[model samples]
Target: MFHKILIANRGEIALRVLRAAKELGIQTVAVHSTADAEAMHVRLADESVCIGPPPSRDSYLNIHQIVAACEITGADAVHPGYGFLSENAKFADILDAHNITFIGPRADHIRVMGDKIEAKRTAKRLGIPVVPGSDGAVTEDAEAKRIAAEIGYPVIIKASAGGGGRGMKVARNEDDIDVALATARSEAGAAFGDDAVYIEKYLEKPRHIEVQVVGDGDGRAVHLGERDCSLQRRHQKVWEEANSPALNAADRSRIGMTVANAMADLKYAGAGTIEFLYENGEFYFIEMNTRLQVEHPVTEAITGIDLVHEQIRVASGAGLSVEQKDVQFNGHAIECRINAEDPKTFAPSPGTVSHFHTPGGLGVRVDSAVFSGYKIPPYYDSLIGKLIVHGSNRVECMMRLRRALGEFVVDGIKTTLPLFQDLVNSRDIANGDYDIHWLEKYLAKADT
Candidate 1:
């Protein structure tokens, strides 16, 4: 076990890692930007160092400053808690060269899975179902048109390096292909510095389901089941539930085993998620997220497992604490992403929180970094907290989530509280009959 570790990010995730390390008798050093000198994570960590300015390029995303902080603090390992450099292969290699442990997968694994084109090919070779589209990247408009025509109409152009729905566009016909391809490449270049784009058949109103799998280094892997993340806006997930309402028990097992087999075949380690798109009872591989997802808490709620601790154990050469048969998914869990944004226009709202009142009761868990008088910064994501609820079944879970959302109170800034309140109360959500476009349609009705 590592005696000390450095956390290379900020916000609630940093605090989440800190709490876990402390429980395992490990000292934690937090590295923060100048904008987060007095942040909640910094206050809770055993020690802290200011890295750089507010801008992410000079601060959170700056690799050198984070490595220097680790050296200065004598940290034996670095735990990158999602985002920033968490999925950067070069950062993992740098830590390896410095003889410091990275509490995640191997650098090679990150490199292989980080590339969307390569991941799909690998999944196909492993016998996993993938959407029909271009074999790889399309460098010319002629090739793009050929691929789009072959795949039929209603195809999507996506960046080879893109995630979170950025650098993606849907073309319904041949006439729209040229503009869609050009726009996607430009956006990809701006966001990821790589303009490479690929084509795939777009499945309208698909359910975004992902399976969480953990590898125990020795080639053993198991799936903790799936998360239903179809409820999203701007390609960002807002609500996630465990044991997808769309999939039956047999199909769930099939998808889970398929993902586990793929991971074992690739020699993957630590924790990763194999995401898929479900449409008309068929599942197609989308991409794999190589780090802990923003929605992992819902899985933990049903499994009673500490994923952070398991990541550390795997990094330290330990095996997974549970096996496939030993893992049992019970009850239903739901999570609402509480963001600092306007419910109407969806604009970012960052400011000091005048008052904070969180819900507490059976099956309600809040993962947050804010408290009374805490100032929310504008330098990063708008996520202020996560409101999670669990119940014996889906119906109870929905009711519990509704009650919890009502109890949550944050003042002095706008939030998406009202949006979720209206969503959970809707009959569509109550019956689990919503598709990816349900929220958009719901909002349109409110406009009148």
Candidate 2:
């Protein structure tokens, strides 16, 4: 076991990792920007260090400063809690060179899975189902058009290194393929500094599903279950639930086992999520996140497994603690990502929180680091917290989530609480009749 672990991120996730480390009797070192000196994670850590100023490039993303902090604090391991340097293969390699363990997958795996084209190839090679499209990057307009025609029209152009909905465009027919390809390539180059693009057959209405798996990097892994993140806006997940209301017992077992077997074969280490798009009883691989996901609480709520704890254990060379059969799924669980933003316009709301009140009771959990006087930094993400609820069934879970959302309050700044409150009461959401495009359409309809 590591005597001290340094957390390389901020906000709720950093606090989440700190708590888990404490539970395992591991001392934690919290690294923060000057803007986050008073952050909750810094306050709770055994030690704290200021990396740099507010800007992420100068602070959170500075590899040299982070490595220096680790050396100074004598932290033997680093747990990058998503975002920033979490998926940076070079960062993982640097840590390895310094004899500091990275509490995640191998650098090679991160490198392979970070690129869309390579990830698709790897997924297909691993026997995971994938969407039909070009074999590799579609460089020329002619190739893009050819792939679109072969895939039957309604193809989507995506950046080979894109995510979060950027660098993606859909063409309904051959006439729209040229503009879509040009636009996707331009956006990809601007966002990721890579002009490479690929084509995939676009699905009209698909549920966004992801399987959660943890491996010990030794041909041992277990799939906790799956989460349905179909409710999204601008490609960002707004709400997520476990055991997917759209899937049944057989569907769940099939997908879950498939992902687990793939991870075991690849010898993947730590926590990773294999994302897919589900349509008409079929699952198509999209991408793989080599780090803990933002919506992991819902999976934890259902499986009763402390993922962070397991991550630390596996990274320390202590193989998986639980076997595949021992992993049991409980009732339904849902997570609402409460961002510090306007409910209507969806603008960023970063300001001092005058009053903060979180909901309580059974089957309700709020993961946040903000307090009454905490000032939400404008330089970082606007997500202030996550509200996760679990119950004996989906109906009970929704009811509990509704009650919890009503009780959640944060004053002196706008929040998306009202949006969740409205979603909980909607008929479509209630019936679980929603897809990847559902939230965007719902928002558009509500505007008019």
Candidate 3:
């Protein structure tokens, strides 16, 4: 086991990793930017280091400064709690060269899975189902048009190295294809410095389902069930639930085993999510997240597994603690990503939190690092917390989530709490009869 682990991110996820380390009796070093001088994770860590200024490029993303922090603190491992450097293969390789451990997958795995184009190829090669798309990036407009025609109309153009909905454009037919391809390539260049784009058949309506798996880097892995993240806005997941309400017992087992088997073959290390778009009783792979997901709590709630703990254990050369046969899924769980944003406009809300209150009771968990008087800096993501609720079944879980959302309060800044409240009362959300486009349509209708 590592004696000390340095957390390489901030906000709720940083705090989440710190708690997990503390539980395992591992000393922790928290690295922070000047903007996060008073962050909760820094306050609670065994040691803290100020790396740089507020800008992410100068601070959180600065690899040299982070390595220096590790050296100074004698930290042997780094747990990048998502975002920033979490999926950067270069960062992982640098740590490896310095004899410091990265508590995630191998650098090669990250490198391959980080690129959407290569990830799709790898997924298909691994016997995982993937969306029908161009064999690789289409560099010319003629090729793009040809691929779209071959795949039929209503194709989507996506950046080879894109995420968070950026560098993506959909074309309903031939007339829209040229504009979609040009816009997608332009956005891809601006956002990712890569002008490469690919075409894929776009499903009119699909439920976003993802299987969670953890591997020990020794061809041993296990799946912990699946999460339905169909409720999204602008491609960002707003709400997620475990044991997807859209899938039955057979569907769950089939997909879960398939993902686990593939990870085992790949010798994937630590925690990873194989995301898919489910439609017409089939699953099509989208991409793979090489690190822990923001919505992981819901999976943890259902599986009785501590992902962070398992991540640390596996990274330390310890094989998987639980086997495939031993893994069990129980209950239904949901997670609401509470962001500091306007409920209606969804604009970022950054300010001092005057008063704060978290929902409580059986099966309700709030993962947040903010407190009353905490200043939500404008330099970071708007997500302030996650409210996760678990119950014996989906109905009970929805009821519990509704009650918990009502109890959640954060003052002196706008939040999306009201949005979640309205969603909980909606018939579509109540019945889990929503798809990837449902939230956007709902919001649009509300605007009209």
TM-score of each: 0.98, 0.99, 0.99
Question: How many residue pairs clash in model 3?
Answer: 0
Name the regions of candidate 1 deviating beyond 4 angstroms.
none
Runs with alpha carbons beyond 4 Å of true place in candidate 2:
none
- Tens digits of per-residue lDDT for model 3 on 1-448? 9999999999999999999999999999999999999999999999999999999999999999999999999999999999999999999999999999999999999999988999999999999999888989987878888888888989999999999999999998888988998999999999999989999999999999999999999888899999999999999999999989899989989998999999999999999999999998999999999999999999989889999999999999977789888878889999999999999999999999999999999999999999999999999999999999999999999999899998998999999999999999999988889999999999999999
RMSD of every prediction? 1.1, 0.5, 0.7
Candidate 1 C-alpha lDDT tens digits along 26-75: 99999988889888899999999999999998988888998999999999
Q: In angstroms, how far off is 383's CA in candidate 3? A: 0.4
**If both were scored by TM-score, which would come out higher, candidate 1 or candidate 3?**
3
Q: Please list the C-alpha lDDT of all candidates, in the order they appear.
A: 0.91, 0.96, 0.95
Candidate 1 Cα deviation (angstroms), residue 226: 0.2
Residue clash pairs of candidate 3: none
